[model samples]
Target: MQQADIHAAAQTLLSRRLNNRMTGPLKAECRPNSVSDGLAIQHRLLELMTQQGNPVGGWKCALPIAVDGLTDVPVVAPIFSDSIYTTSPCPIIADEGWCKIEPEIAFCFAQDLPHRPTPYTEQEIVAALSGAHLALEFILSRYLQPDSVSFIEHLADCLFNQGLFIGPEISLEQAFQASTIELTLTTASTPEVQHFAGKHPCAEPLLPLFWLVNFLRQQGIDIKAGQQVITSSYAGVIEIAPGDYFTLSYEDLGEISLAFTQD
Candidate 1:
């Protein structure tokens, strides 16, 4: 398909908050020759973003395969100007014509992701962490359609990544070494707090750093110097509605509270 065809298709679907249909021939129409080609289109879209003057500020990472509790996918998205927020008690827009709050784990990088190969050693990832935060990622999907959507599609669209509220920063050393930590997510309506509930597979929650870095490297996109990388949520991506309050605690890591509103 022509770039305009794809662009128009994306615009129509996004405008209606719909998912693209990937049917027999339609699938062939939307399909890029290869994953790298798909990424090229995404980059071109980012380049055209300059004409709009709101450059992508950074990036947010997601575990597309992590949904079923034990899977992994290599995809990340640009953190647009409108999506970056100061981590504090804040508001988030939601679907269902409203807004809701969500608490997440976020990481910041100290240096650029080196141009290299996959299976980046744990040491390389550890050395890159500049900061960590108890964050709130506003999880909004384009729509609730599965056939037309896939993990890779979300990655290309910044993973439907709308906005993020970040909290105070701390050294990765502190976040990584902490063991038996508790994470709580709460809202005004619920007495319960969402918890991390399990130990991070590695010593650090920043493990996804290496995974994402390697993913990008394979795609030929350099994680330039001074760019921050927000790792995927180890917990699940829960749905939210408007009028919700949320909080997350990481014991020594820190605590974050957020309120929500609708667009």
Candidate 2:
């Protein structure tokens, strides 16, 4: 794709979302000849982030995990912006539509990880993490082609990452000694409001991170120390309609809730 194409695609998907258009086929447009293709796409976005008039914040990586009722393994495509907010409920309009809201936990890094390096052990990975928190990440995307299949395609199309509402921080070790926790997601809503609950996927959430560290290493990309990683969650995707209150909670961790109108 061309630079203008990248920018235009980013803007359209950012404003409208990936599901807005019904593109015909789910074909792989971005050739994943090398892992750098994906990383390069990420870097391109990182560069674009400077337009926000601030330094690039931390990293947020999303992985897909199983949920009880949701059969389609919806990719947990999330975005990260650093220190944008702290310990409070922030609001965002996802897809300019009323039915979609997201809440998640995020990790902030005090140190930077290698841009590229060899296989990393769990010890090396744990040492790099700085803190954790319950955050609200609004995910938006539009289908360039029918199937939103390519992870790289999503990367190219802005990773369905549009905005984030962040909160307080906690040490990674404190949450789970082994750097992972299992998550459970639940939601409740009255005619007036709705909320989604999330927790570690297993007894440990860090397992996904550990798995991701290896995945990245195998792909030749190094997860820097200061980057943020969001392990997968079991909360099935919740749809938000207009004029409703929404809350996403991570039991014992934190809660990210918000309210919005259809207009």
Candidate 3:
């Protein structure tokens, strides 16, 4: 796609976000037709957001998937500074009276990893982390029918990331060793508890960080200090209602007690 088209698409998406609204696919002339186009739109979207004073605070990514002789590189999106919360009840824009969230672990960076030609080793990557935390990734898509849209379109819209709730701290070692977590969810609305044998989609949570740092480096981007990076979710999306208090227990690592309120 042309640069003008990319900027136009990003502006369209940003307007929807600023207005707290959703729309169908972009206009044909500016729609993303490839991964590169989607990434260009994302880059422009970040620039537009920063211009509006919402700087990038962190990032969210997943492992890469291959299909039809093409690799859909690990999807990535910036987590705006204004959207990250440390306390609850975290206000959210619920869809159809329901709030959606994903349980994941986040690692905060202690130092900057500047762009370089040399690939960063796993040891180097682990050494840079300051701490780990149990986190909930809030979801609210900018598209009307998210499933009906193409992957590129979703990628351009930051993968439905509305915000992030950074919960209590956990041991970095424990988080790294947590290949499987016995998760339990209790809510005020129901007496029954929801149990899930949560498994990291990539087996190791830090693996995606390793891939992400190198990927960004190759793209001439730096991993700045104080930025948190969340890998794959332990459990898929879970829906809860507003005015409901919920507690999520992640095995023995830690638990997060929070309540959801209407945005």
Candidate 4:
């Protein structure tokens, strides 16, 4: 895609986010047809958001998934600073009267890992972390019919991320050991508590961070100090009504509680 096309696509996405609205896929002239094109649009979107005062605070990433004969590259999206909440009663723009959330572990960096030719080892990546935290990723797709769009289109929109809620910190050892957590979810609006043997898609949360650091460096982007990285969800996505207080407990690790109010 040309720079103009990239800007156009990014502008459309930024507009939807600012206006708290959703639309169909981008127009043909500005649509991304490849991973590179999608990433270009994503980069442009981040620039636009930063220009509007919502700078990139962190990122969300997952290991690649293979299906049939094709394998996907790892997925990534920027998490804006303005969207990360450190307190409860988190405000959100609900989709149709409901909100979607994902439970995950977040790793915060203590130092900058600037772009380099050499790959960052797992130990080096871990050494740069300040600590781990329990987090909830708020989801809100810009596309009205998300399923109708291509993977590239979804990628360009930061993989449906709307915001993030950072909760309590946990030990690095505890975070590493949390591959398979027995999850229990309780909500104030419902009597029944939901339980699941939550499993991380990549088995370990740090796997994606290791990949993310290396991937961004290759793109001439640095993993700056204080930025948090949230790996793939452990218990998948859960839908809850607005105003419902919910608590997610990860067996032996930690728990986070919050309520989503309509923005």
lDDT of 2 at 139: 52
TM-score for every candidate vs. truth? 0.71, 0.61, 0.97, 0.96
Evaluate all candidate structures by whole-model CA lDDT and list the values in order. 0.58, 0.50, 0.89, 0.89
Per-residue error for 139 in candidate 3, Å, reads: 1.0
In candidate 2, what are the lDDT values of residues 26-76, reduced to their tens digit? 223433322235344455545554565434444445444343343322233
State model 2's lDDT.
0.50
Report how far off residue 236 is in candidate 4 (Å). Answer: 1.0
Model 4: per-residue lDDT, tens digit, 127-233? 99999898889988889888888877888999989999999999989898789989899999989999988999988778889999999998888998989899999
lDDT of 1 at 182: 67
Between 2 and 3, whose TM-score is larger?
A: 3
How accurate locally is residue 217 in candidate 2, as Cα lDDT from 0 to 100? 59
Which of 1 and 2 is ahead in TM-score? Answer: 1
lDDT for each residue of candidate 1 in 129-243, tens digit (9 for 90 to 100): 6677666566665545634655555544556666777777766666566534566667778787656663443445565566667776776666655455666554545554466
Clashes of 1: 5
